[model samples]
Target: MKTRAAEGGTGGVRRRPTLLSNAETWAQLAVAARIGPEAYAAVGTAAEPGTVLLTVNRPGPGPVVVEAPFGTRLGDVLHACGLRPGDSVLVGGYHGAWLGPVDAAGASLSRTGLAELGATLGAGAIVALPAVTCPLGEITRVAAWLAGESAGQCGPCRRGLPDAADALVALATGAGGPAGLEDVRRALGGAQGGGACSHPDGTARFVLSALDVFAPDVEAHIAGPGCGRPVLGVLPLPRGEGARLEVDWSRCAGHGLCGVLAPGLVRLGPHGYPASTTIPVAPWQEHGARRAVSQCPALALRMRRPERGPGRLR
Candidate 1:
């Protein structure tokens, strides 16, 4: 789990200051300074009085970052990104909502506007799912990645996320049936408010929005012949170029030691074995992960750091 640096000096120990703002916030501040507050406020709506930067992703081209005034129509943004109005769009980012065709047609770029559609303009990311790829499959891939990215400090991250990912996988592959969709919902619901951080809540929002936006496609997989389309990996992931935990199944016994040492990264399955082989190692969890590897009785666990350079996401 990532430990947030606390503010203020405690017992005469001065801690290093941590700046919480992102680059976009800094850029916006610079623009507001240059253009003057009144001028900046004049362009956008009264309620949302400033331009926002959007990282728009569509088919054919790489993701593009553009700035637009708040309250710009979502459809216009799609058109500018080489997408049609009716295409399924993932708003915000990984922890954001999915907008169906009708919603996309009427939605605007402001926070209030998106909230009216039961979504949020979170991180100002808009991903338009192209017709060529399978929506459910893409959703499943993201859910799995989100599960892997869990900080693993709480019950929601340790259990709920992995279960939700499993349920989503079942639904996407046409093996989960109607009950599987319900299972996904239940898992997400179980995670809500159970964590100290917003990771679980944000993840639930993302997956639930996907279920709503891709309702027809989800139904097709459950009730009839599945969408037969391939899962073209269009969505961008954090480049896989870091240290991660891996299990050697051949040399291993189902000891469940990794789960004890690194609860956040390793979860035990029904048979008391690590559920996932390749688990993401958050920077804060490295010490625990090393301990788990060193103490594994069967010597089944190992830490693998890729030698390749950091890759970019499109």
Candidate 2:
């Protein structure tokens, strides 16, 4: 990797304090560089200023830094690093995938790449896992976090995510049965593609992949929780607070109250959940929107403007 220095406006120059590496390697290097050489020596690892490090499950017996093509997906990045088709590929960071061998030949490493694999690069993180790790357990843990990270904006995400997480957690902890798994299915099915943002969709994909990659785990959990392990968090979450809104699916009960209350801002989902319209409420509608927020029965509603600062949501 090439190191670049920053130049000041007053004709002074300074070395950039940070190293540039691929997302996964950079995160690891950041921690290693923090404690300096003595600490690194204690761990038997050394840091090179311009050298980038990557964490691959099955690395070749040589030194290499992959040059991913522009628009490469996480899968594509792995492929560039010599990952082969039918090799087990992890998606969505640690909290992401623990599934089957993916067809890397057909997978890309860009957002588009993971999309083709029914996943997202999500900060361009991708790690491979050996079959030794339980895929279902991995996904179940991620699903729980995804649910908890909800902004409490839309009704489905706010309620459905937590519920889905509970179900997954139950399975992970060996307390859930087929009925519990069914509840997870219901929660996933209901929450899938149902949110003002992609939060719900992303959460659903994580859970679905767990079911796909760990079909045996799902069966084991349903037959009677058989896995004996704690969930490990591997996914990355967005930093700081995110955008917010208010929606109540209960008072809604598919009554289309929001659509009627704020026609331009709400619509009905196929499953009777309140779906948000792309049209934002005009400034003039703020008063009425607040009224709808108050009138919600299931208390499934909210409205919040983003905090403002440099690069903050305006």
Quick one: best TM-score, which candidate?
1
Which portions of model 2 miss their true places by more than 4 Å? Answer: 1-66, 70-88, 92-99, 102-106, 110-114, 228-314
| TM-score quality measure for candidate 2 | 0.48
Report the poorest 10 consecutive residues by lDDT, candidate 2.
44-53
> Per-residue CA lDDT of candidate 1, range 1-314, in tens?
11234434333225444455788788888889999989989988999888889998855668889889999998888787778744488889988898887788678899999998888898988888877788888888788778767777888887788789877877887778999899999999999999879999999999998888889889988986678889898877766645778899997799888889987667677788986676666566788899999999999999977565665211
The TM-score of predicted model 1 comes to: 0.76
lDDT for model 2 = 0.55
Best lDDT goes to which candidate? 1
User: What TM-score do all the candidates reach, one by one?
Assistant: 0.76, 0.48
Query: What are the per-residue Cα lDDT tens digits for candidate 2 across 1-58?
Result: 4334343223323533444456667665676689774554453213222222334444
